[model samples]
Target: MKNIRNFCIIAHIDHGKSTLADRLLHFTGTISDRELQEQTLDDMDLERERGITIKSHAIQMDYTVNGEKYVLNLIDTPGHVDFSYEVSRSIAACEGALLIVDATQGIQAQTISNLYLALEQDLEIIPILNKMDLDSAMAEEVTDQIVELIGCNPEDVIPASGKTGMGVEEILQAVIDRIPAPKGDPEAPLQAMIFDSVFNSFRGIIAYFRIKHGTIRKGDEVKFVNTGKKYHADEIGTLKLTMTPKKVLSAGDVGYIISGIKQAKEVKVGDTITLVSRPCQDVVKGFEDVKPMVFAGIYPVDTDEFEELRGSLEKLQLNDASLVYEPESSMALGFGFRCGFLGMLHMEIVQERLEREFDMTVITTVPNVGYRAMTTKGELLVVNNPSDLPDPSTLASVEEPFIKAQIITKSDFVGQVMTLCINKRGVLTNQVYLTADRVELSFEIPLGEIVFDFYDKLKTISKGYASFDYHPIGYKESKLVKLDIMLNGDQVDALSALIHRDNAYELGKRICLKLRELIPRQQFEIAIQAGIGTKIIARETVRALRKDVTAKCYGGDISRKRKLLEKQKKGKKRMRQVGNVEVPQEAFLAVLQLD
Candidate 1:
């Protein structure tokens, strides 16, 4: 294993980490010409459609440098801030990282965050400036930034184009030279970090990790340090970039080991897999804990699709271990999972995956922040789901999460970005000019405000040239109250939330307007209201239904009558039966969207 090198590709979102992994696999001859496809690491339909890497993918390839064969274990990791915990786990499985900075865009918020993670791990870093083929490429300027920011040798920055496969071979050589070979004793006890795992229908459970010490073949008994569960290896294999199977894996190698563990709860990120008799003196840190900042309920548009929805959530949990979910039941919405997500992008990815993979339509409640509430009984409750909130009279105090955000944009657009943040209840912390055309601005904003498309708004204000990133800054006391909703003089249990005092009026009007658009006109007048406590701040009336039934159904066009009934049934599936007319999920989503 002297020639073995294990490394991971790290970059900001859209910096082409997956694409580069594809190129490396192709160059090493792991994937054949006939089997090759674009973005090979993005095996999921949702990932391909969204152009993001939501999971960490691993592949083993053999490359010959100067007529000497070497094994390169390449791990492709996610670039989003939400999946930073997963990124750390992927990094823990390797001894080196290929830090890719966009040649044109330079460094981004995620890049700096990930780089600090790598530094904390003391991993060997090989900095590469990608997108050299782009018209906006500024190789020299970005190289200087790398030298100043990351303390890398200016000459070591390899200029490469993952799209065109330019200077990619140099990147491989850099990996062999800069990244040190794994130095664990093969004679020692079997120990490995379970960085990632996937469920197999036939084999039960398969776990992927870097063998820190020792080795084992088929039918070997192993133990998990964290869970203390012992089991025999049902199967062992290495993953080819081609998604094919291979026979065995060894120490200093990156691959998955399949066993008789079927459930996801049995295998967890940061757990240790070791030999039953012999174990390592130390167990490596598996991965950082990833907390879901945004919480929302995922209910089926058709309640009968509950089974399918559960199956989709299970399938999603196969690769993405960071997604936290619990069975949540509501009086109005019935039963669903209260899913926790890293951010808006992560939430969208989960929703899209459920729709695409399970072929099921789902309705999600408005995303909410995790609130710490003190009840009248003096019980400190941390509420993630809005439906889990207590009555107003029982509430004592509430605290919401906050974040320190940094925005880099053109000097001219700085004012607009600041205004947008201020309107969102963000406190301007500081500002600095990064360059003549660029200014770096900071803000201390409630995490709830940025959780809903604030990044999109920032880009809109800055004309798509701004870069933004945020980190959690703990919780703060705020004048917050749950703004409940009432329809037709009946309070909707699901439609309530903890909102700040100043934004209640605007939020109330927005909700009313959105409900008007979402709930179709019906025979009975629909009363839409936004309320705080027993007081209603805003209201809108949905005029009674004028004409929904058609005369053709009575004429006995059987197929047409059946189709119309099916359409109405589907529409009713989304609506809550409050007195008369139906209220749909679109109404809930409309409240979150800004015009």
Candidate 2:
């Protein structure tokens, strides 16, 4: 136990965390040359294609130093702001963390936020300067930045290149020398904190946990303190490239346990696991529950497939505990679920994963942020959907969620970046120059403004040099309006959005135009109107597909043709009253893609 070291890697997106992890695994000989692949820790194909780590991955490695063997448990975490919950959970189960900074990019917004999370957990932080092999690497400047940020000595930061495996030996040596081993009494009651879990069709649900006290053995009856569910520890093992069965796993070790638990809700991530024979006195205080930043409805393409969709979500929730959902029915979309996600990126990844992993075709509604509405009687209501908003005539003001956003970029793009934020109704709170050429700008912005296209636009205007990170500050009263899109005088609740009053008209105009292009022509004309409180802000029409009754009488008398045309017009007017518009899936998607 004294020779065991548990640590995780945390960094900004594309800061070489996974690459560094790949090098570590290879140098430790945990994986052979034949099995080694780029971004080996990212198992999902979506992760590989996007070059991002969507989930936190845990693995164990064996090392020999000074003629003594040591066991190291390492968790590789995602870097995006949306998956910060994953980072927090990973930090909860570790004794130390490797704060990796890109040599070429210096310190980023996400890198700083993740470091704070680790600091809050009181985990020992070891700073490492990665990407040393690149020609653009600014090792000296970046090393200084790391020292100033973490308050560590210049000598404490190790310079390494994940691509060439530089300083691999030194990193491994630091883990054993600096990171303390797990502290617990083996004779104490069995206590463990499940940090992550996955679903297995053949073996049932597999939960990965870090033992906090005592030992767990195969066939032992373990009980989850949170859910109060009991299960037999059918199999226990450490996570290498694959699961290696062990008869027993004691305190300080990270391992997986399978109990043939089929129900996804039975095994909850962050729950305490203790033996039924000798349960622990206190529950494990893991990370807090995930706070979702964006809400949207996900409905099956076919109404009857609702049950199948629920099953898929349950299984998916087991894998991704950050996902929060509840059953909801819509007038236009039929039955579906309103799921809360960490951000737009997280929402997109979940939608894509459902389609690819579970073969569930779904339509996602317009994403929005949760709001607090106070009624005339002083009753506060949580509005997760625009349709849930009370009448505008209600006697109280509405409060919108706001966030403190930190953006780091070069000085050249500062003007453009500031303009973009101000246009989003963000108020500049602070500005500091970390270096002469690099600046860190802080703004208190409404969460709703950044939910849709803020991230995409920031990347564009800064030419991909800016990194943005934000956390909720609290609720602030704002003049907001619920923008509803109507089709043929009927409200399409699924396409509605609660937006700031100042920008509502511009946004409504954009949506109306975009929908006009997306919705196909019907038998009769379709009116696409965006309205707020019965006042139409914008409108567009999709002309009907005209079938000329006069086409067959081109050479006939003009009076006869006019009579026939008038008859066709009357029939078209009647058809318009009864015809129904079939909104294609692409139109719903286009609303989300509106610029």
Candidate 3:
């Protein structure tokens, strides 16, 4: 077991972390060529569709070099900043990290951010330069950048093309040579950290953990260090990483332990697991609970599908604890869920999964940031839903979440990127040229401002050369106003906001155009208006919706026709119960899209 090693692949979005994991999985004979799906660890439908890993996935592999068998526990972590906590928790389970750098896009902002986290964790870092197969690949330059960034020998960098399996053998050898073997006493009291979990209604809670010391086995009574709840382990299984199961796992092994635990809350991602017989006094520091940054209300298109939607959420939560939802009743839209997510991308992935995986149609509200309201009545309110906001007259103070954004990009687009950040009310805090061709720009900007299309804008401004990584920098008191849209004379709660003074007009205009695009031709002329205070700043007329309802129904397709009407009625049910006009699902997302 001295040769055994565990490591995680870390990178930024589209930096090819999952692709690399897939290549390793194939190279180690973990998955056969015919059975392999691209980015196999991204098993979730949402992950595949979005081309991003929302959750951390782990698999074990057995590799032989010079006739010596070594077990490598490979974990693929989320690269998006929204899932930063999850990434940290995943990295905690490993002793080292395969820091993958895009050869063509060397040392991105997120790459540096993730590397910093790994360094703080004291994990041995093995740099791997990927994307050598690309036509514009800069393998040697990227290796040089990695050497400078990490202060490691340039030749130590393992240049691999995960796409074509080039240099994969070299990477495997480097992992065995450079990554440290797990260090802990197997004879001591059993101690482990529950880094992740998946709850199956049939198998109960499956907790994946890394044993820090001692041994845990089938039928051993275990206690949760934090909660003090005890359970008898029913079964112990190790991932062969070859897409199958092994009988048991011992110290330094990464695998799942099932104890017939039903609830997910029982064994959190960061909870400490220890033997009840000989408990250890030392408590391991677990990752903090993920606080959702972006929120949106998700409603089924058909009201009758409410139960189905809830069931889908329950199923998704089995694999993803980060996906949170609570019952939300809308005045226009019927029963829906106030879903919490790490960011906009997280929310979109869940929404897409619900539709594709469960075949359920859903209408989602515009994504918004959680607000901390200091009311005139001396009440501190943390509002996740716009519907929960107090009336304007009752408010005394309002503040929103902000982020410290770090951008690392080419020098040519410094001015363009700076202007974009400034337009979003970003205050430049620091600036430095990382290299002759690269500049690192730091700013304090509203988290909400950067959540929507900021990544795309950064890429646009930098001509696809810039990268950004931001983390929450706490809330700040700002000159803020809630812009409300009145459909007729009544406020449309869904179309409300907390906006900065200078941005209200532009935001309102954007919302109006979005409304025009979302609101199909209705039976009656609808007035779309965006207002700041009592003044309407932007207005657009949505002509009566045309071609919405089909006049004819074929006799052979009565079931389909009835299903369609039922869906329409269900949609109408979810729409707030205003006096007369019914708002469509598209109206909620209109202001969210730029094009």
Candidate 4:
């Protein structure tokens, strides 16, 4: 165990985390130069296309110094705020972290946030200045920022470039010198903490865990402590560029185990694994339970695919433990699952992955934050969907969750960023000048206010120079009301949303207009109305697809044309009454993008 070191890489988005991982693998000879690629750990195509690491990847590398062999388990984590949960899980299994900051962009919001996570876990921190090869690299300024943020010595910060493999050997030496080895008793009962897992159609569920005590062999009988289900280890291996099967993995070692279990629910993240023959008396406290900040309903376009959707979600949950969902039924969207996500981006990624990976066509409802309602009867009720809210008459008050948002941007764009957050009902709590031209502003804003397009707007106004990160700060009483969208006098629950009272009229108007363009014209006119309870506040009309009845009566008697027109009008009115207007899938998605 003295030669074993477990650590993870954390940084802001686009700070060259995956790129740095590629450099480390190359320097350690874990992969050959012929096999090297950009963002080698990021295997998902979506991640490569978007230039972001959506999932945390773990790999083991062997490094030798002065003829002494050492094993390093590296977990590369995501940098986006929405995926911070992945960073936290990675931190839980490691004893140290590599805090990489882009030299051109010093100490962004996510860099600070991820640092706090590592500090909380008591992990040894190794600060490194990345992207030093760039012409615009601010080496001295960024090193100062790193020193101030982590309170480390200026000389301790390593200057490196992921593109050129600079300072690679220094980083390796630091890991061996500064990071402590994992401590455990190899002779004790077997115990492991499952940090992540993945599904395989050919075999079954494979759980990636770090052994805390004792040893696990290839064919040991294991039992997941959380589920109490037992299975024989079909395969036991270490995670390298590929799975390298081993006869036994001792304490303080990271490895994967295949139990040949088919059900996704049985293998839960943060669950402890122990041997069935000689189980550990005490379970390892894995990590905190994931809290989802955004809720939305995901329904299959084809109603018959409900079971398939559920199965796909179960498998997805095995991969992403932060995703929580429950069975729900929408009047307009048939059977679906009310999925809880960490943020809007997390929700979008899950939706896109469902389509791409599982080949499932799903319609996602408007995203909203979970609310707490205190009823007239003095009962507190949790409302995840707008339709789940109690009747207005019986409701005492609605409380929406608030978050403490941190925005770090240039001094020139400070005023613009402040105005945008203020319009979203945010109150500036504090501000500090990180440097002569850079500032960090803090605000207390309702979570729902930023659920729609706040992130996009902030990036635009700042010209992509600002970095934002936020955490929930409990709930506060607010003037909020549920806005319902009525089509032909029938409410579409899928389109309804709970919004602040002040912005209701304007947002309602915008949604109505946006829907007008998105919903295709049908044989009958569709009346799109936005209402608060029984009072309509905004309305739009999607005109019916008209067939020229007068075309057949050209050059005929005036009465013939008039009679044809009157007959057509009567048919239109009848069709409007009986026919149900179909709201296209795009309408639900477009309403989220309304300016």
Tens digit of lDDT per residue, candidate 2, span 85-197?
Answer: 99999999999999999999999999999999999999999999999999999999999999999999999999999999999899999999999999988889999999999
RMSD, one per candidate, in order: 6.8, 1.5, 8.1, 1.7
Off by over 4 Å in 4: 545-567
Residue-level lDDT tens digits of model 4 in 233-330 = 98999999999999999999999999899999899888999999999999888789988999999999999999999999999999999999999999
For model 2, the superposed segments whose C-alpha errors exceed 4 Å read 551-563
Candidate with maximal lDDT: 4
TM-score of each: 0.90, 0.97, 0.86, 0.97
Model 2 reaches what TM-score against the true structure? Answer: 0.97
Question: For each candidate, how many residue pairs have backbone atoms clashing (under 3 Å)?
Answer: 2, 0, 17, 0
Poorest 10 consecutive residues by lDDT, candidate 2: 548-557
Give candidate 3 misplaced runs (Cα > 4 Å).
Answer: 33-37, 133-135, 225-229, 242-248, 304-308, 509-579
Local distance difference test, each candidate: 0.82, 0.94, 0.82, 0.95
Residue 159 deviation, candidate 4, in Å? 1.0
Per-residue CA lDDT of model 1 for 23-117, tens digit only, reads 88888889898878988878887778778888888888899999999988888989988788778887888889999999988777788888888
Q: Write one digit per residue (lDDT tens) for candidate 3, span 1-595.
A: 5877989999988888888888888989988989788888887766787788888988888899999999999889988877777788878898899999988888888899999989988999999988988999987778888999999998888888878988889888989998999998888888898888876768887888888888887788999998889999788777654324445456788878888886656766677888899998897776666788888889888899898898888767766668878998877678889998988777877887788777988888778888898889899999887667677788888889998989988999999999999988899999998778899999999988876788888888889888888888798887778888877556787778777878888888888777777766655566788886678999988764334444566566678777777776666545425326667766777666754
Off by over 4 Å in 1: 242-248, 304-308, 545-580
Can you rank all candidates by TM-score, best first? 2, 4, 1, 3
